[model samples]
Target: MSLLTTLNDDIKTAMKAKDKETLSVLRMLKTAIQNEQIKAGRDLNGEEELTVLSREMKQRRDSLAEFEKAGRDDLADKAKIEITIVEKYMPEQLSEEEIRQIVQAAIDQTGASSAKEFGKVMGAVMPKVKGKAVGNQVNAIVKELLQEN
Candidate 1:
Protein backbone atom coordinates (compact mmCIF):
# COMPACT_ATOMS: atom_id res chain seq x y z
CA MET A 1 0.00 0.00 0.00
CA SER A 2 1.07 3.60 -0.51
CA LEU A 3 2.60 5.27 2.52
CA LEU A 4 -0.25 7.77 2.72
CA THR A 5 -2.89 5.06 2.63
CA THR A 6 -1.05 3.05 5.25
CA LEU A 7 -0.65 6.12 7.42
CA ASN A 8 -4.35 6.83 7.16
CA ASP A 9 -5.27 3.32 8.18
CA ASP A 10 -2.80 3.38 11.08
CA ILE A 11 -4.17 6.72 12.21
CA LYS A 12 -7.62 5.26 12.44
CA THR A 13 -6.33 2.25 14.32
CA ALA A 14 -4.44 4.45 16.75
CA MET A 15 -7.53 6.54 17.40
CA LYS A 16 -9.66 3.47 17.99
CA ALA A 17 -7.13 2.07 20.42
CA LYS A 18 -6.75 5.43 22.19
CA ASP A 19 -3.02 5.38 21.49
CA LYS A 20 -2.23 9.04 22.01
CA GLU A 21 1.49 8.88 21.25
CA THR A 22 1.05 6.86 18.06
CA LEU A 23 -1.94 8.95 16.97
CA SER A 24 0.05 12.14 17.38
CA VAL A 25 2.99 10.80 15.37
CA LEU A 26 0.74 9.51 12.60
CA ARG A 27 -1.05 12.84 12.29
CA MET A 28 2.27 14.64 12.18
CA LEU A 29 3.55 12.31 9.45
CA LYS A 30 0.33 12.65 7.45
CA THR A 31 0.62 16.41 7.63
CA ALA A 32 4.25 16.28 6.55
CA ILE A 33 3.34 14.13 3.56
CA GLN A 34 0.45 16.42 2.59
CA ASN A 35 2.69 19.46 2.90
CA GLU A 36 5.26 17.91 0.59
CA GLN A 37 2.57 17.04 -1.94
CA ILE A 38 1.29 20.58 -1.88
CA LYS A 39 4.77 21.98 -2.25
CA ALA A 40 5.46 19.73 -5.26
CA GLY A 41 2.03 20.33 -6.82
CA ARG A 42 1.48 16.59 -7.06
CA ASP A 43 1.25 13.47 -4.95
CA LEU A 44 4.58 12.02 -3.93
CA ASN A 45 5.95 8.85 -5.50
CA GLY A 46 7.29 6.07 -3.26
CA GLU A 47 10.80 7.48 -3.36
CA GLU A 48 9.55 10.95 -2.48
CA GLU A 49 7.50 9.53 0.37
CA LEU A 50 10.57 7.72 1.61
CA THR A 51 12.50 10.95 1.48
CA VAL A 52 9.95 12.68 3.71
CA LEU A 53 9.95 9.80 6.17
CA SER A 54 13.73 9.74 6.24
CA ARG A 55 13.82 13.47 6.92
CA GLU A 56 11.48 13.03 9.86
CA MET A 57 13.59 10.17 11.20
CA LYS A 58 16.77 12.21 10.88
CA GLN A 59 15.25 15.15 12.74
CA ARG A 60 14.26 12.97 15.64
CA ARG A 61 17.69 11.33 15.76
CA ASP A 62 19.42 14.70 15.81
CA SER A 63 17.09 15.90 18.53
CA LEU A 64 17.76 12.74 20.49
CA ALA A 65 21.47 13.40 20.33
CA GLU A 66 21.09 17.00 21.42
CA PHE A 67 18.77 16.06 24.26
CA GLU A 68 21.17 13.42 25.49
CA LYS A 69 24.12 15.79 25.34
CA ALA A 70 22.24 18.29 27.50
CA GLY A 71 21.21 15.60 29.99
CA ARG A 72 17.51 15.87 29.25
CA ASP A 73 16.55 12.25 29.54
CA ASP A 74 12.84 13.01 29.37
CA LEU A 75 13.03 14.73 26.00
CA ALA A 76 15.59 12.26 24.76
CA ASP A 77 13.28 9.37 25.62
CA LYS A 78 10.45 11.05 23.77
CA ALA A 79 12.65 11.57 20.73
CA LYS A 80 13.65 7.91 20.87
CA ILE A 81 9.99 6.91 20.83
CA GLU A 82 9.32 9.21 17.89
CA ILE A 83 12.25 7.70 16.05
CA THR A 84 10.91 4.21 16.63
CA ILE A 85 7.48 5.24 15.36
CA VAL A 86 8.92 6.75 12.20
CA GLU A 87 11.15 3.75 11.64
CA LYS A 88 8.07 1.55 11.18
CA TYR A 89 7.48 3.19 7.79
CA MET A 90 11.07 3.26 6.59
CA PRO A 91 12.66 0.74 4.27
CA GLU A 92 14.64 -2.05 5.91
CA GLN A 93 17.98 -0.54 6.89
CA LEU A 94 21.14 -1.99 5.39
CA SER A 95 23.63 -3.61 7.76
CA GLU A 96 27.13 -2.20 8.12
CA GLU A 97 28.56 -5.12 6.16
CA GLU A 98 26.13 -4.52 3.32
CA ILE A 99 26.89 -0.79 3.31
CA ARG A 100 30.60 -1.55 3.23
CA GLN A 101 30.13 -3.81 0.23
CA ILE A 102 28.08 -1.22 -1.63
CA VAL A 103 30.56 1.54 -0.83
CA GLN A 104 33.42 -0.62 -2.04
CA ALA A 105 31.57 -1.33 -5.26
CA ALA A 106 30.91 2.37 -5.81
CA ILE A 107 34.56 3.25 -5.19
CA ASP A 108 35.64 0.65 -7.71
CA GLN A 109 32.99 1.66 -10.24
CA THR A 110 33.87 5.32 -9.95
CA GLY A 111 37.62 4.62 -9.76
CA ALA A 112 37.80 6.86 -6.71
CA SER A 113 41.29 6.00 -5.48
CA SER A 114 41.73 8.57 -2.74
CA ALA A 115 39.98 10.79 -0.21
CA LYS A 116 40.25 13.60 -2.77
CA GLU A 117 37.61 11.74 -4.82
CA PHE A 118 35.20 11.49 -1.88
CA GLY A 119 32.47 13.35 -3.75
CA LYS A 120 32.67 11.01 -6.73
CA VAL A 121 32.23 7.91 -4.58
CA MET A 122 29.45 9.48 -2.53
CA GLY A 123 27.58 10.57 -5.65
CA ALA A 124 27.65 7.05 -7.02
CA VAL A 125 26.85 5.30 -3.73
CA MET A 126 24.06 7.56 -2.48
CA PRO A 127 21.69 6.76 -5.32
CA LYS A 128 22.13 3.02 -4.92
CA VAL A 129 21.70 3.14 -1.13
CA LYS A 130 19.11 5.86 -0.94
CA GLY A 131 16.62 5.36 1.94
CA LYS A 132 18.37 2.09 2.79
CA ALA A 133 21.47 3.38 4.60
CA VAL A 134 22.35 6.44 6.65
CA GLY A 135 24.58 8.81 4.68
CA ASN A 136 27.02 9.28 7.59
CA GLN A 137 27.57 5.54 7.95
CA VAL A 138 28.13 5.14 4.25
CA ASN A 139 30.47 8.12 4.19
CA ALA A 140 32.57 6.78 7.05
CA ILE A 141 32.80 3.40 5.37
CA VAL A 142 33.82 5.01 2.09
CA LYS A 143 36.50 7.08 3.80
CA GLU A 144 37.85 4.09 5.71
CA LEU A 145 37.98 2.01 2.54
CA LEU A 146 39.47 4.81 0.46
CA GLN A 147 42.15 5.56 3.02
CA GLU A 148 43.17 1.91 3.00
CA ASN A 149 43.53 1.92 -0.81
Candidate 2:
Protein backbone atom coordinates (compact mmCIF):
# COMPACT_ATOMS: atom_id res chain seq x y z
CA MET A 1 0.00 0.00 0.00
CA SER A 2 1.05 3.58 -0.52
CA LEU A 3 2.35 5.38 2.54
CA LEU A 4 -0.68 7.65 2.74
CA THR A 5 -3.04 4.73 2.47
CA THR A 6 -1.10 2.88 5.14
CA LEU A 7 -1.19 5.91 7.40
CA ASN A 8 -4.93 6.26 6.99
CA ASP A 9 -5.36 2.60 7.78
CA ASP A 10 -3.19 2.94 10.85
CA ILE A 11 -5.28 5.89 11.99
CA LYS A 12 -8.31 3.67 11.93
CA THR A 13 -6.42 0.99 13.81
CA ALA A 14 -5.25 3.48 16.40
CA MET A 15 -8.79 4.68 16.95
CA LYS A 16 -10.03 1.11 17.26
CA ALA A 17 -7.28 0.26 19.75
CA LYS A 18 -7.91 3.48 21.70
CA ASP A 19 -4.25 4.39 21.30
CA LYS A 20 -4.64 8.10 21.96
CA GLU A 21 -0.99 9.07 21.61
CA THR A 22 -0.47 7.15 18.40
CA LEU A 23 -3.76 8.47 17.08
CA SER A 24 -2.76 12.05 17.79
CA VAL A 25 0.61 11.74 16.10
CA LEU A 26 -0.90 9.96 13.09
CA ARG A 27 -3.47 12.71 12.70
CA MET A 28 -0.74 15.34 12.83
CA LEU A 29 1.17 13.51 10.11
CA LYS A 30 -2.03 13.28 8.04
CA THR A 31 -2.56 17.02 8.35
CA ALA A 32 1.01 17.77 7.35
CA ILE A 33 0.73 15.59 4.24
CA GLN A 34 -2.57 17.20 3.25
CA ASN A 35 -1.10 20.67 3.71
CA GLU A 36 1.83 19.79 1.47
CA GLN A 37 -0.57 18.50 -1.20
CA ILE A 38 -2.62 21.68 -1.08
CA LYS A 39 0.49 23.82 -1.29
CA ALA A 40 1.74 21.91 -4.32
CA GLY A 41 -1.75 21.86 -5.91
CA ARG A 42 -1.36 18.12 -6.45
CA ASP A 43 -0.97 14.86 -4.58
CA LEU A 44 2.59 14.07 -3.57
CA ASN A 45 4.55 11.28 -5.20
CA GLY A 46 6.56 8.82 -3.09
CA GLU A 47 9.60 11.06 -2.81
CA GLU A 48 7.48 14.09 -1.90
CA GLU A 49 5.62 12.07 0.72
CA LEU A 50 8.93 10.91 2.15
CA THR A 51 10.01 14.56 2.30
CA VAL A 52 6.92 15.37 4.37
CA LEU A 53 7.56 12.43 6.70
CA SER A 54 11.19 13.53 7.17
CA ARG A 55 10.06 17.07 7.99
CA GLU A 56 7.65 15.76 10.64
CA MET A 57 10.41 13.59 12.13
CA LYS A 58 12.79 16.55 12.25
CA GLN A 59 10.23 18.69 14.04
CA ARG A 60 9.75 16.02 16.70
CA ARG A 61 13.51 15.67 17.16
CA ASP A 62 13.91 19.43 17.60
CA SER A 63 11.06 19.51 20.10
CA LEU A 64 12.60 16.59 21.99
CA ALA A 65 15.92 18.40 22.30
CA GLU A 66 14.31 21.62 23.49
CA PHE A 67 12.13 19.83 25.99
CA GLU A 68 15.08 17.91 27.40
CA LYS A 69 17.17 21.09 27.64
CA ALA A 70 14.37 22.74 29.66
CA GLY A 71 14.15 19.70 31.96
CA ARG A 72 10.56 19.12 30.91
CA ASP A 73 10.66 15.37 31.31
CA ASP A 74 6.95 14.94 30.66
CA LEU A 75 7.08 16.94 27.43
CA ALA A 76 10.31 15.29 26.42
CA ASP A 77 8.75 11.85 26.87
CA LYS A 78 5.82 12.89 24.69
CA ALA A 79 8.19 14.20 22.04
CA LYS A 80 10.15 10.97 22.18
CA ILE A 81 6.95 8.99 21.62
CA GLU A 82 6.00 11.23 18.70
CA ILE A 83 9.48 10.88 17.24
CA THR A 84 9.38 7.07 17.41
CA ILE A 85 6.00 7.08 15.66
CA VAL A 86 7.17 9.47 12.97
CA GLU A 87 10.37 7.50 12.40
CA LYS A 88 8.31 4.41 11.53
CA TYR A 89 7.18 6.13 8.33
CA MET A 90 10.56 7.42 7.22
CA PRO A 91 13.11 5.54 5.16
CA GLU A 92 15.64 3.53 7.11
CA GLN A 93 18.32 6.01 8.13
CA LEU A 94 21.78 5.60 6.64
CA SER A 95 24.62 4.85 9.05
CA GLU A 96 27.39 7.41 9.55
CA GLU A 97 29.84 5.18 7.69
CA GLU A 98 27.48 4.91 4.74
CA ILE A 99 26.98 8.67 4.73
CA ARG A 100 30.76 9.23 4.93
CA GLN A 101 31.26 6.98 1.91
CA ILE A 102 28.63 8.90 -0.10
CA VAL A 103 30.13 12.24 0.92
CA GLN A 104 33.54 11.07 -0.15
CA ALA A 105 32.09 10.07 -3.54
CA ALA A 106 30.34 13.44 -3.85
CA ILE A 107 33.59 15.23 -3.15
CA ASP A 108 35.33 13.17 -5.81
CA GLN A 109 32.49 13.74 -8.29
CA THR A 110 32.51 17.51 -7.77
CA GLY A 111 36.31 17.62 -7.60
CA ALA A 112 35.90 19.59 -4.39
CA SER A 113 39.36 19.71 -2.79
CA SER A 114 38.91 22.36 -0.11
CA ALA A 115 36.49 23.90 2.37
CA LYS A 116 36.10 26.80 -0.09
CA GLU A 117 34.12 24.42 -2.35
CA PHE A 118 31.81 23.23 0.46
CA GLY A 119 28.65 24.48 -1.20
CA LYS A 120 29.43 22.71 -4.43
CA VAL A 121 29.96 19.41 -2.62
CA MET A 122 26.83 19.85 -0.49
CA GLY A 123 24.66 20.59 -3.51
CA ALA A 124 25.98 17.49 -5.21
CA VAL A 125 25.48 15.28 -2.13
CA MET A 126 22.23 16.43 -0.50
CA PRO A 127 19.91 15.16 -3.22
CA LYS A 128 21.51 11.74 -3.13
CA VAL A 129 21.23 11.49 0.66
CA LYS A 130 17.96 13.30 1.26
CA GLY A 131 15.79 11.76 4.04
CA LYS A 132 18.33 8.95 4.45
CA ALA A 133 20.73 11.02 6.58
CA VAL A 134 20.46 14.17 8.69
CA GLY A 135 21.85 17.30 7.01
CA ASN A 136 24.15 18.54 9.80
CA GLN A 137 25.65 15.07 10.26
CA VAL A 138 26.37 14.82 6.56
CA ASN A 139 27.75 18.37 6.52
CA ALA A 140 30.16 17.59 9.36
CA ILE A 141 31.36 14.42 7.66
CA VAL A 142 31.86 16.29 4.39
CA LYS A 143 33.77 19.06 6.14
CA GLU A 144 36.04 16.56 7.92
CA LEU A 145 36.72 14.73 4.65
CA LEU A 146 37.33 17.94 2.69
CA GLN A 147 39.76 19.26 5.30
CA GLU A 148 41.79 16.09 4.95
CA ASN A 149 42.04 16.39 1.16
Write down the lDDT of every candidate, Cα atoms only: 0.93, 0.92
Put down candidate 2 lDDT per residue, 1-149, tens digits, no spaces: 67879899999999999999999999999999999999999989999998998888888888888999999999999999998898888889999999999999999999999999999999999988889988889989999999999
Give the backbone clash total of model 1: 0
Error of 1 at 75 (Å): 0.3
Question: What tens digits encode model 1's per-residue C-alpha lDDT throughout 1-149?
Answer: 89999999999999999999999999999999999999999999999999999888888888999999999999999998898899999999999999999889998898988999999999999988888888888889989999999
Prediction 2 TM-score vs. true:
0.96
Instruction: Give the best candidate by TM-score.
Output: 1
Per-residue lDDT value at 147 in model 1: 100
Which candidate's lDDT is highest? Answer: 1
Reference-based TM-score of each model: 0.98, 0.96
Residue 38 lDDT (model 2): 96
lDDT of 1: 0.93
